[model samples]
Target chain A: MAVASDTIAAPEHSAEGRSETIAFLIMTAVLIVAPFFIYPLFLMQALCFALFACAFNLLIGYVGLLSFGHALYFGWASYLAAHAAKVWGFPPELAILTGAATGAVLGLVAGSLAIRRQGIYFAMITLALAQMMFFFALQAKFTGGEDGIQGVPRGKLFGLIDLASNNTMYALVVVIFLACFLLILRIINSPFGEVLKAIRENEPRAISLGYKTDRYKLVAFVLSATLAGVAGGTKAIVFQIASLTDVHWTMSGEVVLMTLVGGLGTVFGPVAGAFVIIAMQNYLNALESWVTVIQGVIFVVCVLLFRRGIVGEIAHLLRIKL
Target chain B: MFEIFGIPSNALFSQLLIGLINGSFYALLSLGLAVIFGMLNIINFTHGAQYMMGAFMAFFLLQYAGLSYWWALIVAPVVVGLFGMIIERTMLQWLYKLDHLYGLLLTFGLALIIEGVFRNYFGSSGLPYAMPDSLRGGQNLGFMFLPNYRAWVVVASLVVCLGTWFVIERTRLGAYLRAATENPTLVRAFGINVPRMITLTYGFGVGLAALAGVMAAPIYNVSPQMGSDLIIVVFAVVVIGGMGSIMGAIVTGFGLGVIEGLTKVFFPEASNTVIFVIMAIVLLIRPAGLFGRTA
Candidate 1:
């Protein structure tokens, strides 16, 4: 599968790769200038979600594995970071790192257990595992249960730059988002990423060709989980809170929806999707149930008729990868 | 009261009975999921929402039509089944050629829309569903008293479950369904209406979930969010059972529910998560599941 894709993708691969890079540059530039015109808090929230969706996209896009319970990593990290910052009085960067490390451990344990199943069972297993974490968070006293870890301090970045300034915090969030985004891109384009794709296209074939497919999959899962944790930790710091809402199944569903709405495998599609969905919530807060209905309708529409999504469709029409 | 291991025998019996009742619902719901997944290949994420709709159907029938519980048991499944058929015809059927995950996503959307709309109108608080006169009394068996309605739920669900098993595993109609799903083109070549059968199969599967919902109304409050939470657990049941056989689904559903009940008695804190914990263990030990075939 890898060799076959190489032959087919070789010709268009450069063009697609070039276009993707261009799109990334354009997006980064827009985002850099974005905080100047918009509410920094709202933009920070959107960027956080976008980063989460991108981490989620790495698995489903490159590995063809749909993890239905990703809130475990995201929410768990958010809580951990909240606790670390508020209780330990740790710096923001250190708290975020602590959260991401915990996320990696969680991914290693969960990803190993979940990889035992394939296809539909795989999705269900991840979801069930995440639900277990949700229950833990609910019952565990350190998590603060339903009330969550409120009044979490953002704290100083690197114990140097005070993150109290909206613009300064925005700069940190944007940097984090860009770094994670680029890391995902580099991972997928690397030789390891090719093997991951081959495994996705046909695992037996990849295994037959002497590749340890399971290890690759496990690595991909851990990377996705840790990256999702980073996004969640950043979000908690921005909002200065960590709550049950982040750990809910609906939150997991939201990440999946964003990835789908953007384009599963497309590089920048999740960012677009994250913005679109957050915007919907921000603008249509009054609609209540209708917002949920609309999200559902979008889910249905994306799956049935528009699987390529907004950015994906544009890229497809232009014969370029996003 | 007699004691067993420092616990009262009556308390144990009551929990056992509660387990049996919960098991019945799980069996019915998981059976429906297995049946639909057999033909449609979709996990039917909206199964929970449809189950809620079934309870709502009974609620409305009682409120406006003044129908009895007996009538609801007979009527709700049919109405909800037809609605499912419409969904299959209009939406689900289109995704057969695409990846099955798309169907899951699409049905998830449908579930959200259904649950959200209902929640919008009714609010999250549950509505009361009174026990019918015919099934309200309890039977005293010296050690423990048994609620007639609860017993009836267990019996009815068992009958429906095994009846489905018999039809699918032993009958000619079941053979045709097996043949149709395994190879529709080949089955169609033999002069059968494969498409119609597929549609009806989906309807029948959906009907089973509604039936369970109807059974649950008097036991639990009639609420919109009721099926949503239950459905997630049932999905764990389906995974643990492996969707390879009808009886496997039934067995896993009941067994897990009973285990969950036992957890409630023994370690109340873990009751809510025991099924999922067992699911993870099963995945590690027997990834194909207890009764499931290796995929």
Candidate 2:
């Protein structure tokens, strides 16, 4: 499996690598400059969601596993991170790490159960598990029931740099986002990633070739969950609260919508998708359920006519790998 | 009345009854899901929303049309089922060639749209659906008091479930349906309208969900969010049952409901999640599910 992947992936990387680098550079420049003109808080929220969608895409886009209950990881991480910062008085960095750890642990448990069944059953299992967590969260005391963990102190980054100011926090979020983005790119381009793609393309063939596809899928699931946790934790810190809304299935659906709108398997799709969705949510805040309606419409449209999404279409038209 | 397991019999019996009622709905919903999945190869994420629509349809009938519960039992399913058929024809027909996940996503979107639109007009609060006069009273069993309505719900749902089972497993039309499920191309060559059959199958499945919703309206109240909450639990039940056979879906649905009810009595904290816990254990033991054959 390893040898076969190397031969196939090596040539594709050299050609695709240049385009990916350019896209990354362009995205970084946009992140750095856009806050000057737009609201930093919105940017922070959008980036957090972008990271979340990217993590989600790692499973669906690359691994071909559609998890319908990812809000479990993202939302639980937010809760634990908020709890750590508020109740435990941990530093911001440590709290975020705590959240990420929470996601990894939960992902390990849920992924094992979900991967037991393939295809549609996998989605259902994950969703059920996530819903289970949601009920647990509702009953758990530290979550404060419906009120959630509010007024979470965004403590210093390393017990040195004060992150009370929006500018400092935005900068911190951007750095973490960029670092995670690079790590994801690196993972996707690695040998392990090639095996993951192979599993996605043909699990039985990969298994016949001696690849333990389940292990690869489990590892990918955990990685995606951990990154999702980071995104959720960061959002909790930025928003200064983590509520039931984060853990709800709707949040899970929202992430799916973002990834779909961006492009399912494309490198730059989730980021664009996240930004578009967050902007829509921010602007449509006054309309209440209409936002959900609009989101549903977009989902229908994307699936029916625009399955490639914004970035996927662009990449296709230009004959480039996004 | 005698006590069992250190608990009052009345409390235990009452919880058990509630569990049976929940199980009835679970059986109905999961049966619909299984039937639809068999023919359409889609998960029908909008089943819950359609169920909600059925309850709302009943409410609308009572409020505006001066129709009674009896009328609603016949009307709601047809209306909601027609709506589902329209959706299947216009949207779901295109997704037959794609990955099954797309169907799930598309239906999920449809669910959100339906729920959102309902929420926009009705708000999130529950609308009351009155109990019919004939089914309003209760009966005193040897051990516990059973509401006539609750008993009727169990019996009606059981009959419906078994009837569906019989139709699919025994009838000639069901034979055609099963044959189509196995190989649609071959069924089409044999002069059956596979596409129309698929649409009707989807509609029939949706109608069953609506029927459950109609039955559930009096007990749970008609609300937009009702279907979403219940649907996830039904999903867990489906996972446990394996969606392999109709009987499996019905039995698992009722059995899990009873188990959940028992948990509520013995361990209240875990009551809400007992089904999911059961699902996890079932997956560990039989990945294809208890009733499902390994595919």
Candidate 3:
């Protein structure tokens, strides 16, 4: 089971070589030109969510782990970064790093706790833990409960470059998102990624092969959480607010939707998925009340009929590795 | 004058009673989830929504049909159970051959739809469900005054949980069900209609949630969001108890409830998070859960 599943690792192999070069060029061109066709802020938001979803995919696709509490890391890190920048007057870059570090620590604790059980139990454990954090945030003084930590200052990037300007901020976001995306791609192509696939396919076999599977899962989980935090923290800087919405269970569900719609386990699928879903959400936000129902319908349709998702199906039809 | 750790005995007992009451609901919901998982191998993410539906069904029954709580007790489960059958027959049955996670996703979608529609129609605010007149008022229990309705909820849930255990563990039908759960193909070879049984099993599990909902309506306000929140806590209870044994689920549910209640008295700040803390500790101590078998 481990060996057969390891074949999926080959996809990551191609992802690192020429494919990555093409992807980098395309993404660079898009980032450079996106502001001309679209609002820079909207593009920044999409990029943030795209990075969040990709980080999430690292766990579900490669490790076959479905986390229902990812919102905890995203939301908590956002809160941390927001507090640092808004209250403590930290630079934007420092705030982002604070958020990422917070996520890594949270991921370590949550991952250690969740990895005790496998499969559905793991998902439920993470979800329950996240809910605990939700309650903590609800009652904690700094969170401001329903009001949340609002009107956060973006501050200058590295205490030099002002992010008050739209274009400057957008460029900063693009740089961060691209770096995170490339880092994820690199990690997935490495031997570490192959081992993760091995554990996902067959845990006992991987253990028998003398691979300390738990450590790999923990590392992947922490990495995923840290990246998700980066996205959330960046969003806080962009929007100048970090609220309960980021940490809510619905946010976790939205990440799952992005990954599923994009293509689970595919490198670029989550990014594309994030763009499509965010665009759909932007359109649906106009209706406001009806959005939940629409989201529900999409979930049903996706699970039942479109399981392989848009990119996965396209890849299959084209016979080109996604 | 009597104090336990600087807290009044009355306060502690009252919290313990509240804990027991919460535990009863947790036991009922987690038991339902475990039973559904047994045969279907799918976590019924819709269990919470179904529980909420039960409360709504009761509300509708009383408002439109002029039915009493007695009638609701009898009719609500059947109504929700039938709904469960429909969902299983049309959507869930098709996914049985696929990964179990798909079932979780599908039910999650169903839950969102149900909760969304209800929220859209009723708004997020809770509706009042009057306790039956007979179960109203309080009983003087020496140390603490126990609300009759609260006491009844605990007893009733206990009866239902035990009754289910009896049916699944002792009855010939239960034997067949267990046989089917272990090896559906082999059980089918014996001419048992395993698919139909599977559908009904889902109905039965759903019915258990509805029963809890009916029991809970008067205590907690009948709201669309009620079940969704409670369901996550119950999932934690299920994890702590380890879904390996029915008794384990029941005991853990009630035990955690009491523990949470005690936390409320000792450290009110941590009341909401005590169960999760316990869950983390349990994971560290016994990863397979207290009664769960090592895979």
Candidate 4:
């Protein structure tokens, strides 16, 4: 089993190196030219969700921990960042950082509590914890309950560039997303990541090997939460609002769908998955109530037969790492 | 004239009664979850939706078919159980070879589809399921007013939960079920149909959830959103109870429900979230859950 994993790891390592180059090139081209073709705001929304899905993938794919409650971190951070920028008059970068920090702290606490069990129990724990957050947001005055914290100012980026313009905001988001994405990629290839994979395959074996598995799992959880926070924070700025929908259990499930649909273990799978799902959502949103039914169908289909997901299947057919 | 914690005994007792009622539903639902988990190794995310389906079934029976609540009680669970059986046979049976997480994901998807369709057909707003004429009105306890229907709910759920417990824990049939849960292949070797047992177990679990829905209809508004919200709290309850023991799920369910009621009295703002807070604490102190065996 170890040898099989290592063989898989070898291809993945070379694949990661190749994909990073491709990603960087694609991002550069998009930054330079895509704005002319696509709407900046739409692109910004996609980037935010893309980052969120990638962060989510970090835990589920790499660590083999499927968190059904990630929206707590993402939604809470969005609320904090929205409130900070809108109510406290903070700069965009600071607000975003504050959101990420909040998510890391929350992840630390939630991870400590959730990592007590394995597999299905772990998923349930995270889900229940996130639901608790949803209730908190529903009642907390700062969250404004159903009204939410709306009309948030985009504020200035790094105290210099004005984000009120779509083009500048898009550029800013693209940079933040690329940095976070690369950071995830780097972590996946690190020794720390290998231990996570080992733990994923067999925790008892990993523990017997004298590795402090808990510490590694905790760090991975925190990192995933923090990056998800970054995505949520960016989303708040782009939408100029943060609502209960951001924190709902449904949102958490949506992210899971994105990751699963993209490819669970693949590095770039979540990004591809997020784009496809977000675009599908966008298209379905025009159809009103049918969106949820369609999303549900997609989820069932994916789980029942399409386990490799869009990117995973593509990677397999193309004979290349995603 | 009795007093506890500086509050009137009437108010306290009344709240306790409400807590017990809520706990009954929780106990029933979590019991179903544990039973399903035992045999199928799948957490039925659609349990809540199916529960909602029970209430809807009762409502539709009354509204369209002119059947009474008593009749619906007998029929709703059977209908919902049949739906569950079909689901297990068709879609869920395919997932047994994959990771357990896939089962969770698949059930969650089914839940979404069920809830979404219900919401689309019925609208997001709640529909009222009127109390049957036979079960309407209050009992008027000397200290506190005990609504007759509420008392009926509490008693009915307790009976159902206990009956389920008996079937799963005490009966010879239950021994076969337990043996299958422990080692299905061995049970199969003994000439017991393990696969059929799994399908029936899932059906029975779904039926339990539907029964809870029937009990809950008059107490809470019969809404499309009803089960989706309640299921998450039940998930926490399951975690707290550890899904290890039948009686544990029952005890934890009722205990958490009472605690939540107390929170309502002490801090109304936290009422909705108290169960989750307790789950967090439970996870910290007893990660395997109160009744769950250490993994």
Question: In each prediction, how many residue pairs overlap at the backbone (N, C-alpha, C within less than 3 A)?
Answer: 0, 0, 0, 0
Answer with 2 or 3, whichever has the higher DockQ.
2
Candidate that beats the other on TM-score, 3 or 4, i.e. the better one: 4
Residue range A85-140, candidate 4, lDDT tens digits: 99899999999998999899999999988888898999999999999889889988
Please write out the lDDT profile of model 4 over residues B64-169, one tens digit for every residue. 9999899999899999999999999999999988889999999999899999999989998888988999877788768888888988888888888888889888
The number of the candidate with the highest DockQ is 2
Backbone clash pairs for candidate 2 read none
The TM-scores of chain A alone, one per candidate, are 0.97, 0.98, 0.94, 0.94
- How displaced is residue A303 in candidate 3, in Å? 1.0
TM-score of 2: 0.98
Better model by lDDT: candidate 1 vs candidate 2: 2
Model 4: clashing residue pairs?
A: none
lDDT of 3 by residue, B1-295 (tens): 3899999999999999999999998999999999999999999999999999999889989999999998998899999999999999998998999877788888888888899999989999999998899988998978889999898889988998998889989999999999999999999999999999999999999999998898888888899989998898999998888887888889988888899999999999999889998989988888888889873
**What value does DockQ give for candidate 1?**
0.82
Backbone steric clashes in candidate 2, count: 0
Against the native complex, each candidate's DockQ, computed on alpha carbons, is 0.82, 0.84, 0.73, 0.83
User: What RMSD value applies to candidate 1?
Assistant: 1.2
Runs in model 1 lying further than 4 Å from the true structure:
A1-11
Q: Each candidate's root-mean-square deviation in Å?
A: 1.2, 1.2, 2.1, 1.8
